[model samples]
Target: MIIATGATGTLNGATVDHLLQRVPAARLGASVRDPARARHLADRGVRVRRGSYEDPVALRRSFADAEQVLLVSSSDIGADVVAQHRTAIDAAAAVGARRILYTSTCGAGFETPYPPLAIHAATEQHLAASGVAWTALRNGFYGDLGQLLGPWQETGTIAKPADGPFSWVDRRDAAEAAAAILAGDAAFDGPVDLVPSSPVTLADFAAAASELSGRHIERVVVDDEDWVAGEMANGTPEGAARFTLSMFQATRGGHFAHADPTLVQLLGREPRSIADQLADQNIG
Candidate 1:
């Protein structure tokens, strides 16, 4: 049996949906925190089990009788993310899971300015020592650039610290690649960077916005502190503002500039670019 945690979430849900097409529902299982939310999967014959990262025993029970398990990263912020991942990893190992797949970020590394990247790096280390074969799906930075440039959409001016390029990827593509790996069509051990073929800079985004919306969007470089203050003045929480600034700092440091072709190989086609994503959205 193959089990997927966070099966009700968008990413994992898409992965499970694709898996259902290739594998029988009887062989598929969803380990979600809320079984009631996943009744649709159960109605389709998938075994839905209750599991939460906070409870190791529940995780073990949810993973039982599964040959492969997909551990979708926990969404809890400010919590002990590393400990939560360790708990899930331990439970997966204890349940005799032959292999485990973890959803990680492409920017996950020691030098990343984002705190969650450290947690992901640490979780990867724990997975390495967990004895079960594992694959770290290093998903690229999400293609939700519009959310980050929220103020710019209104002001028609994008202001931020000097930034580098990012190979933003659509979550749908990431989920499909993950499903291929889970379905045994593609084999990957250790970290696999799933990113687009090219990196996109903030200037590139502004240009895309201009073209897609029929309006000129200017890109301006500002001091990091000024940007953080602006975010806070706009009613963003202090902690969230600081984290957003750190992400820009990390971007300026070229932490997210790399591009990997693994996603293309897995999908058997070129993945969508930031421009394509922006064109689809009404960012105007």
Candidate 2:
């Protein structure tokens, strides 16, 4: 069975769809924080299990009858993810899972600026030592820039921390690649950089935004400290601001810019472009 965490989220939903199309419903397991949130998955014939990354007992129960498990990194801020992931991994190991797949940030190889990237890197180290066959989807930035919560892009400028290049991947594409890996039909057993084919700078992205939305969008380059403070001022929790700032700082450091060719090779098609993704999100 393929047990998928974060089944309520965008990436997990797409991953579950791909898995269900290839594997049978009985072979699919979905671990969601809320069973009610997974009604669609149940309707589509996936075995829905209510669980969270924080609860070890729930995780253990969720993986009881699983051959493979996918840990979509929790959306929690700060050290919570590390603890939550540890709980899940320990549970999976105890439940005798054959293999585990972790969704981590791209370039989490000790050089990424995102502090959580360090958490993922450390998790990878622990997974490696756990003696379980594992794979890391080093995912880059999400392509749904226009679908952010709160204000629409038209209300204000698209704010990103960096003026550097970015290789944004469609969440659907990442999920597809992940589905392929989980199927275990090939000899894949290491870190796979699930990035886009082309790396676009912040300026290029702003241009795309303007062209797509028919609005004159601008990119605001803010220092990490200033950005954190601004987020706090804008009613974000202090911890949330710090965490968001860390990711932006990482982007400025080129942590999300590297475009690995293997993504297209594995998908056997050109991954969707940022314009294509933005359009799909109904921005263009």
Candidate 3:
């Protein structure tokens, strides 16, 4: 059986949804923290078991008799992410899983102003050192960039600290690609980058917004402290405003610019573009 952890989350939940289409439900299992929340999946014959990274016994039970385990990266901010991943990896290996798949980020191994990259780097190192085989799905920046991009549609100006390009790829594509791999039991060892066909900078986004809105949107460079002040003045939490500033610094330092055709090759199609998402969200 193929076990997918974090089945209730958007990325992993979508993977389970797609897996139902490609493989027998009986052959799949969902390792969720709350089985009650996954009633829909349980009704569809997918095994929903309660599992928590903090509880290794529960995790082992959820992963029992599994050929592969899709270990979703823990989203517990302000927690020891590496230790949590280590617990899951140890459990999967102890349960005799042939392979362990982890959802990682492209920021791994890059020195960045952002703090999360360190966690990813440490988790990947642990995965590599584990005796069992492992694969890391190095996903691109999947979260909403509204915080980084700001409300350029309304202001017509993209203002921030120096920023660099990002190879954007939709999380949906990443999920489906992962599902395809798991269903076929494809051999993908080590970290595989899942990025878009091209990179996009804030300037590129401004141009796209202009085209979609029929107006000229300008990309403006502002001092880092001034940008933070502006964001805080606009009611952005002080902590969030500062972290967003660090992200801009990381981008400017070329942290998230990794690109590869692996994602396209996996989906056998072009990943969705920024314009497509902006249109779908009705972002004017």
Candidate 4:
């Protein structure tokens, strides 16, 4: 049997949806924080269990009788995400899981300026020391560039801090690749980067938007402090604004510039490009 954490969320939910097509519902389990939200899955005959990284006993029980578990990383930005992951990893090991696949970031390392990158790195280290087989799904940066672009359709301008390139990837493609890995016969040990076929800078993204919408979208580079202040003025919390600003700092440091083909090889085709994603989303 296979169990997936965060099964009600977008990425893992998509993975579970794909898994249902390849595996029987009896062989599948969903570990969600709120089982009430996952009633649709249960209605389809999936086993739903309440699990939380904060509760080790519940997590252990959720993983019972499972051969493999997909540990989707938490979205809590202010919490001690490393400790939460450690609790889940220990619980999976205690349940005698054959393998644990963790969703990690592409530039998760000690030197990255992004705070979550360090948390992911620490979790990977803990997983290595655990007495269970592990695979780190190094997913690329999400392709929700519109959030940073700030109403580009009406403003006709994309403003951000001066940054470097990033290999943006759609969550849909990442979900499909993760489903393939989880349901495949072969084993993938250690870190597997799921990135796009190529990387694109912010200017390149603006150009793509301009071409897709047939509108002149100007790319404006602003100071980091000015960007943060602007975000706060727009009603974003101060902490959240600062955290979002760090991503550009990390990108300027060349953390997310590299492209990897692991996702392409897993999917048997090239991953979607930034231009295609923008065009599909109809972002001006």
> Estimated TM-score per prediction?
0.96, 0.86, 0.95, 0.96
TM-score of model 4 relative to the true fold?
0.96
lDDT of 1 at 149: 67
How does candidate 2 score on lDDT? 0.79
Q: Please give, for residues 31-147, the per-residue lDDT of candidate 2 as tens digits.
A: 988999999889988898888887889888888888898998877754567778878888888999988889987768677656777888988887787678888888877844643
| Candidate 3, 122-203: lDDT as tens digits | 8889989888888899888877868657788778898877788877777799999899888874699998888887778889
Candidate 4 structure quality by residue, lDDT tens digits, 172-255: 899999999999998999998899878778898889889988989999998999988998899999998888888999999999
lDDT of 1 by residue, 259-282 (tens): 888899888999876667876675
Ranking by lDDT: 4, 1, 3, 2
Q: What's the distance in Å from true for residue 50, model 3? A: 0.4
Preferred candidate (TM-score higher): 3 or 4: 4
Which has the higher TM-score value, candidate number 2 or candidate number 3? 3
RMSD of each: 1.4, 2.9, 1.5, 1.4
Error of 4 at 220 (Å): 0.9
The Cα local distance difference test for each model comes to 0.88, 0.79, 0.87, 0.90
Where's the lowest-lDDT run of ten residues in candidate 3?
107-116
Error of 1 at 244 (Å): 1.0
lDDT at 74, model 4? 90
